[model samples]
Target: MATEKRNYKRVMLKLSGESLANDKGFGIDPEVVYRLAGEIKEACETGIEVAVVVGGGNIWRGLKGSQGGMDRASADYMGMLATVINSVALQDALEKLGVSTRVQTAIEMRQIAEPYIRRKAIRHLEKGRVVIFGAGTGNPYFTTDTTAALRSAEIEADVMLMAKKQTDGVYDADPKFHPEAKMFTHLTYNDVLQKQLAVMDNTAITLCMNNSIPIVVFNIDVPGNIVKACKGETLGTLIEGE
Candidate 1:
């Protein structure tokens, strides 16, 4: 069969830290990371520039800590550190597959990864190296989702690929609990906002909306889905301007 033409030359992949975890959802699973890396390597082979922003929820959740009475900033900093760890692990997995990769952290950690530099990151992507962004924008009170949005705009990505661990796409309600829920294949930014869908936080959604970057929200566990998403084969909910 002939391959479909790719719609995007560059993309920002938004991943939750839980995507790197095992079924227990508490720690990094080497097998899972390796599988994910292999898929990413496939996407790179297609010549698409892929950048990643991974959350740290598997290791720590800053908001949860703050809710438990910890200083919010300190807790958020700890969460950033967790993302660094996940980024390093993913970098290792990708490199093992013979894919050149770079880990850039918003918060500087000279010994572990390079500091985030916009121009340098774009250069790396241009050279076919996958760049993993860690540390969640180097600030407290910002999510990795927001980091993905911010970086996608700065790097001029064609689309934001949200590889969700939960549902395959945006739906009217939680499909897990509501079997009759409807999945939307496409949506407008205003529809997402007005319906209060949880596709992304409002700030992240607004950022993409303002910049006119399309977002694809899809399930990550299905094998080959990542490559399909990169090729724009239409597997999930697509959010863009009307």
Candidate 2:
């Protein structure tokens, strides 16, 4: 693939924690990690800078923990730790595939990974290293989706690639439940907010809107979707400002 034809120079990839879980469910699935790494390696090899934000829902959901009576902040902190674990797993997988990668956490954890440094991360990407962001804002009550938006704006990415586990694109309703639900090929940020499409949280959507960053929501179940998205193939719902 020629680099000049690619639409995006740099992109922020948001991966759900559930995507990393095996068929049995819960915890990191090495197979999934390796497969994802392969796809990402293909994208990076195209000369596009890539940054990733992974969710921790497979390991822990702070909201669920809080609903079960755990302190909200404490539960959220635990969730952050879960993201770190996923980030490390992804970093290891990418490295093993011969892709240079870096795991940078918002909260300091010098033993395993470097602390998140905005300029340092940008430099890494410029040098052709993939930077994986973990520890979601280093704060409670924010989803990795928001982290993706925040980091995307901070790093000046061309688009945010939202990798869904089973969902193919943004739909009028839950496609899993409603077989006839309409899948949107293109949408405006306002349309998502007006319809409450649920492609991402309001904060994430609003952040992208304010930053004028586009988002590509696509199925990650397919092996090469990530590369397809990086290649600017029309394979998913594209969300942007009107």
Candidate 3:
């Protein structure tokens, strides 16, 4: 198959932890990881620098832990560790596929991965390595979505890709519940904010808005969608400034 012309030089891909889970939605699914890694490798082959931020919801939800009576900070820290596990799993899969990859965490864990250094991460990207960011900004009370936005800005990514597990694009309502929910092919950052779309958390959306980074929300389960997004093939919802 012929590849499309690329549109982005560098991009940040935001993935949910559930993306690595199986049908039961718990723990790492090696099949899922390998499939996702294959798609990411294809995107990287397109000459687009890729950095990933993965959520830890499948392993642990800090909010859920806190609500269950654990200290919020402690729970959040556990959540951060979950992200590191996912990051390493992804790194392993990508490397097996012959893609050069790096896992950097906001929380230092030199034995497993490098600590997040903005300049070093950027240098890795420039050298054609896929960088995975873990630990969600090394802070409590922030979503990995926010980490994606922050990392996108720091890496000067041309676009941010929000990879949904099953959903294809941003909809006006939960499409699963609302079959008639409208999917906007194109949207402005204010459209997302004013309408309170669930595309991303407000902090993540605002960071992209402030940095003028475009975002593509698409279904990651669909093969080749990642590369399509990198090529600007319009398979998903695009959000940017008006």
Q: Write down the TM-score of every candidate.
A: 0.97, 0.97, 0.96
lDDT of 1 by residue, 1-242 (tens): 21244489999999899999968798999999999999999999988899999999999999999999999999999999999999999999999999999999999999999999999999999999999999999999998999999999999999999999878999999998999999998899999999999998999999999999988999998999998999889788888898
lDDT of 1 at 129: 97
Please state the error at residue 30 of candidate 2 in Å.
0.8
Misplaced by over 4 Å in model 1 are: 1-6
The TM-score of candidate 3 is 0.96
lDDT of 3 by residue, 1-242 (tens): 21233378998989899999967688999999998899889989888899999999989999999999999999999999999999999999999999999999999999999999999999999999999999999999999999999999999999999999879899999989999998888899999999999988999999999999988899988888878887778777888898
| Model 2 lDDT at residue 86 | 95
Better of 2 and 3 by TM-score: 2
* lDDT, candidate 3, at 225: 87
lDDT of each: 0.93, 0.92, 0.91
Off by over 4 Å in 3: 1-6
lDDT against true structure, model 1? 0.93
Per-model tally of clashing residue pairs: 0, 0, 0
Candidate 2 has an lDDT of 0.92
Every candidate's CA RMSD: 2.5, 2.7, 2.9
Per residue, candidate 2 scores C-alpha lDDT tens digits across 19-138 of 999564699889999999999999999998999999999999998999999999999999999999999999999999999999999999999899999999999999999999999999
Deviating ranges (above 4 Å) for candidate 2 = 1-6
